[model samples]
Target: MFIAIFSIIIVLVVLGALFINLSPEFGGTISDSQKEQFSKSEHYKDGVFENLGGVTMSMGFGDYVKGLKGFFGPQINTRPKGAVPINALDALELANYKGPARMVWFGHSTFLYQSYGRNILIDPMLGPVPAPHPLLGGKRFSEELPIAIEQLPQIDFVVLSHDHYDHLDYGSILKLKDKVQMFFTPLGVGAHLVEWGVAEDRIKEMDWWGETSFEGFSIKCVPAQHFSGRGLSDRGKTLWSGWVIKNDGANVFFSGDSGYGGHFTEIGEKYGPFDFAMLECGQYNKLWHEIHMMPKETAQAGVDVKAKVIMPIHWGAFKLAMHPWTDPVIRVSDKAKELNLPIVTPKIGEFIYLAEPTSNGGVWWKNVD
Candidate 1:
C-alpha cells in the first residue's frame, strides 16, 4: 500500500514537471548574464525581485483556506449577464488619425496609443483567456476584439508592464512580434519575449526610474507595487512596473497593476500633473489588497499622480475577483466625484482623445444586466 501511494505521488510530480517544461506559456528562464545584471538593481536581492516595503501575499494557512473559499464560493454578478458592448475600430480612421494623440482601451489593461503617427500597444493581452489553458480561466467578457490582431495597424512599439499571463499573453505576442518595431519592458521581462521569438536586439529592458527616448517621445519605467510570474516557479523572477509616456504633445501615465503605494506621489512629483492617467481599479479583495488597490484607492491614486483626468482599468474584461463586474467603475466613479476629479469611463474600443478626454459614451454598463 505504501509503495502504491509513493508511485502515484512520483507520477504526479513527473507530470507537473513535464507540463511546465513543455509549455511555451511558462515563458523563458533567466540566464546567468541576466541574473548578474538584475543583481545591480536595489530591488533585486537574494536572487528575486522584491517590492518596496514588501507585500504579504498570504498571511498564513488560514488565509490560504479563506482564499480557496473565496475562489470556490458562490458569487453573484461577477460577470455581466449579457454580452459586453464593444465598438469596432475603424481601420482607416485609426491609420489616418492626426493631431493631439488618442488611445483606445481594448478592455482590461490593454490600450492602443497613437501619437505622431506611431502606434504603441500597452499590455496587449488580446487572447480569449488569461491563463495557460482556456479551461483554467474563462473567456473574456467580449467574444471578439475591436480589431483582430492580424488587422491591427503596423505597431511601432509594444510596451509590456510585466510577465503576468493576463498582461503578457503568449498567443498575442506570437501574432504581434512580426509587425512590431520595438518592445519595451521592465528588467528581466525581455527574457520571456526572447524565448517567445522576439528578436533580442528589438527588446529593451528598463529598470525603475530608467528613461529613454524614441523619436520624440520620452518613455520612463516607473515603480509599481506588484509581483510577476507566468508560471508557479518563477514568481518575482522578473520586475513589474508602470510607465510614464510623454511627448511634445501630451503626457500620460499608466499605473500597471499596482496597489496603493507612495510610488504614486513619487511619480507625480517626478513627472506629475499628467494630461491623462489610466489606473488599475479591479480584482481586489481584502486578502490581496496589498497587491491590487480597491476602487476608492484607485480614485485617490489619480489625485496622487496629479492627473488632469483619469480612467479606471484592469476591469471590464475578465473577472479575477469576487466583486460584481460593475462594482469597480461605480465605486471609482463615486470616489472621483467626491474628490472633484474628472474621470472618463470609455467603452471598449472607444477612442479617448487626449486634448478632450471625457466619457463620450455615458454609463453604458448600467444597461447591461
Candidate 2:
C-alpha cells in the first residue's frame, strides 16, 4: 500500500511538471492589469478553489477533462473519403470591396473584415483543430481553407476575445504573429503570446474598456461574460472580452465569445447604431447557458447593439454542442425573423457586403450532412 501511494504521488508530480515546462512559455507572472480587472470584476468565477480566485472562470480543468473524454470517445460519422465538403463552392470573393465594409465568415467565430482601407482579423483560426491536443479534440468541416490567409490583404491588427482554444488557436497565432502588425487582447493573455515567441512590444493588454487606435480605426475591449486560460494552471488570471470597433466610415462590433447579458444594451446605447454586428449564434446548450447564449439571445443582442445588420457566428463548424449542428441556424433564423432583426446566414467563406446593409440571409447549411 505504501509503495502504491508513493508511485501515485510521483506520477502526479511528473504530469504537473510536464504541463508547465512543455507549454509555449513557462511561468508568466500575473500582470497588474489582470489583477485589477479580475480581482473585482463580476464575470470572474472561482471555479476550482476560493484562494486562487477568478483563476478558472471560463474553463476549469475539470471541464476540460470532461470535454477531452467526450471528444475522444465519439465518432459522429465514421466516413469514407471524396466527401464534396460543405461550402465547396467558390464561397470566396475579394469584391472591389470599395463599400464602407465587407465581412467574411471563416467558420465559427473566425471573421475577416475590410473597411475604410483597413484590414482586420478577428478571432481568426485557420487551423485543423481547435484544441491544444488534436488527439483529444474533434475536427472542423472542410479540411481546406476557402481562400488562403496569405491570399488576403495585409493585416493591420488582430483582436482576440479570449484564450479558449477555439477562439485563440495556437497554429493561427504562430502564423499570424509576424504577418500582422499588432495584437490586442485582454489582460494576462499577452503572457501566452510572449511565451509563444511573439514580441512584447507587438502585444497590447487591455482591461475592460482599454482602447487603441491605428491610422483610421479604434478598437475598444469591452466586457465579455467569459473566461480564459490555455493550460490548467492559469485560468482567469487573464481577462476575456468582445470588441467595439470604430472606424472612419462604420462602427463594427466583434463578439469574440459571450453569453447573453445586459451588457449588450449598455454597449449598444454607449457606442452602437453600428453598421453591422457579428454575434455568436451556436455551440450553446442549456448546461452552459450562462457562458453561451441561446439563438434568441443572439438576435436580441443585435437589436440592443442598435445594429442595422447582424451575422450569427460561433457555429457552422466544430460541434462543441450536440444539437444536430443545424439547430442553431434554424433557431436563430426563426428568432431573428420573429424579432424583426436583420440577419445574414452566409456559407463558410462567403464575403458579406454591408452597404448600409442588412442581409436577411440564405439557408446555406440546408442539406449539410
Candidate 3:
C-alpha cells in the first residue's frame, strides 16, 4: 500500500511537470523542424524509438511496479563509519585552480575544465537529488555547487550529454540562462533550452560527429550506447551522445554517460592519446549494465581512448544504484592498476592539472569494495 500510494503520487507529479516542460506556453516545444531533422539520423530515425517502444510495451504496468520495488529494494549506500568528511577537496584550494589545463570533479558527472584560458563545464548537476523529489531519493554530499551559477566566471561553454534529469536539471538551466555565454547539446535538447528562454542564436545543436565552433574550441557530438527520455512522450525523440571537445593542441573526451561499446576504439583512433578523459564510473547494475558500464569496463574504456590519465566520474553524488557508494571508485582503481591505466582520482571540488595533476596525490573515494 505504501509503495502503491507513493508511486501514484510520483506519477502525478511527474506527469504535471512533463506537461509544463512539453507545453508550448512553458517550453515552446511546438516547433517541429528540429524533430524532422532529428529523424533524418539513421540510428534515431526509426530504430531506437522502435526498440524503446518495444521495451516499454513489453514491460506493461506490472514492470513499473517491479521497478518501484527495485527502487525501494535493499539499500547498499551507507557512508563509511568515520569516513573522511567532504574536505578532501581542500587539495584543490591548496593549489588554487590557476593551472594552464585542469579538471575538477564536482561529484558525479559535474566537472569544470580550464584549458587555454577557457573554462567549460560538462553536465553540471548541482542539485541535491537527481530526482524531482528530495524526500524520495538519495542526497548530494556537497551543499551547493562549489561555484554557484552566478559565481561562475565567464564560462566559455556548457556541454550536455543528454536530457536526463540527472544530466539536465530545469532549475540549474533557469539559474544559468543569463549567466552562461553559450550552450551545446545534441539535437532535440535545444527544445528545452528554447523553452527556458535561451535565444535560438545562443543554442547550438548537433548530431553524432556533427561539429560546431566556439571562438577557441570545437565541439563534436559523438555516439554513446544509451537511451533518452525525460518523460513518457519524449523517448528517442531527442538524441543522446558523448562529446569530444578540442582546442588546437589538446583533446578532451568526456564520456557523458554510456555503456562500454565499440565506440571506444572508434573514438580512440580518431581522438587518441588525449591529455585527459573524464569517463563515467558509477551507478550501474545488471538490469541496465548495457547502458552504464561497470567499473572494470571503465578502465578498458580509458585504454580505448588512449587516454594518458583517466579521472573516473559519475559516482559519489546521489546513490542511483545498489552498489556501495565507494564501489565504483575502488573497482576502477583496481582495474586501472591491473590494466596499467593511469587514473587520477580526485576529491570533490579538487582540480586536476592536465599537464600533471597527479604530482600531489589522490584519495577521493577510497572506501567501498
Candidate 4:
C-alpha cells in the first residue's frame, strides 16, 4: 500500500505541474517559422537561445537538490513592517509638462518614460501582484499604486525587456493594449503578447543590436545576461535584453536584468555618456548570481555604462529573494557614493525630471518601517 500511495502522490504532483504549464498565462510555444528565423541568429543554437559569453542555464541534479534544500531557508526582513510610501501621478500636470523628458517609476522594472513628444511605458507591471496566479506570489509592498491602469494616458509605445512574469505581466498588458500605439520587445516575447490578445501587427520583435526609430527616438535592443521562461518548458527559448533610447541629444539606457559583465563596457563604448540609466539592483542571490546583479554590481554597471545618473530598479516591490526589503537601495547607494555616481532613489509613482541634475529623488525607503 505504501508503494501504491507513493505512486498516486507522484501522479497527482505531475498532473498539477502539467496543468500549470497548459495555462494561457504560460504563453504559446515558438512556431516552426519562428524557430526557422531564430535558428539563423548568432545567439540561437542547439534548438535554444544562447546568452552572450556562454552562460549555463542548467544545474546538475546534485546542485539542484542542494538548492531545493536551501530554498526554504530563513529570509531576513523580506517584507516591511509599515507601508511603503507612494507618490501618485498627476495626469494633467504630466500631460501638460514639456521638456527634458520625464519619468515615473511604478516600482520594480516598470516606468513611464516621456521624450521627443512620446510617452513610452517600460515593463509596466502595474498589477497588484506580479505572479500569474494570485496565490503564487506575495502581496505588493506598497498599499496601492498612485494611479490606476485606466487612468494612465495613452501610451505611445510599450517596451518589454523579456517574458519573465515580473517584467511581462499578463494583466498589465491587457490593460495597456488598447492604450498603447505599439509594443517593442526582444524576439520570442511577442508570442506572449499575442497570446494575451495584443494584435500581432502592433508588436515588433527586435533582435540584439537591432535599431528602430519612432517619433525621432532611436531605440536599440541590446544584450543582457539573463534567461527567460514563464513555465516548466520553453526555457531560454526567448531573448532577454536591455535598451538604449536616444533623441535630441539626450540618451538613456535601460538595463533590464543583467549580472556584472563586459557587456556594460561594450555598451558604454558603443553608446556611452548616457544622460541617465536605469539598472536592476534587487532580488538577487549568490545561487542565481549569474543572472541578477548584486547591489554593488549594479552601481559598478552604471559607471561602466557611462551613465551620468543611475536609478536602481527591480526592488521596492514584492520580495523575490532572501535579503531585507530595503537592502538593495542601501547597498547601491553606498556604492554609488563611493564611486561618486549621481543616483536617483525615487518614491514609487514620483515623477523624475531627467533634465535637471538637482531633481534627485529622496531616500523615501529609509523612513519605511
Question: What RMSD, rounded to one decimal, does every model reach?
Answer: 1.6, 4.9, 4.7, 2.1
Error of 4 at 366 (Å): 2.0
Write one digit per residue (lDDT tens) for candidate 2, span 1-369.
999999999998998688666755232546666565556655445521121222213556887677666556665532212332334323134523445677777888988788866678899878878777677577877677767665666687888887888888877777777778888888677777886778999888787767788767888988776666666777566778889888777788887777888778888988888888889888776656667889999989999889888988988767677556777778888999999888888777666777755343365555445
Number of the predicted model whose TM-score against the real structure is largest: 1
Candidate 1's error at 19, in angstroms? 1.5
Between prediction 2 and prediction 3, the one with superior lDDT is 3
Cα-based RMSD of candidate 1: 1.6
TM-score, candidate 3, is 0.84
Model 4 Cα lDDT, one tens digit per residue, 229-320:
98877889999999998888479999998877889999998988898899999998777788999999999999999999999999998788
Top-lDDT structure, candidate number: 1
CA lDDT of each prediction against the hidden true structure:
0.93, 0.73, 0.74, 0.86
Task: State model 3's lDDT.
Answer: 0.74
Q: In model 4, which runs have C-alpha deviations exceeding 4 angstroms? A: 1-11, 14-18, 57-66, 357-361
Cα miss at 236, model 4 (Å)? Answer: 0.6
TM-score of each: 0.97, 0.82, 0.84, 0.94
**Residues 132-221, model 1: lDDT tens digits:** 888789789999999999889888898899998899999999999999999999999999999999999999999999999986889999
C-alpha positional error of residue 185 in candidate 1 after TM-score superposition, expressed in Å: 0.2
Off by over 4 Å in 2: 1-20, 25-99, 356-361
Q: What's model 2's lDDT at 367? A: 48
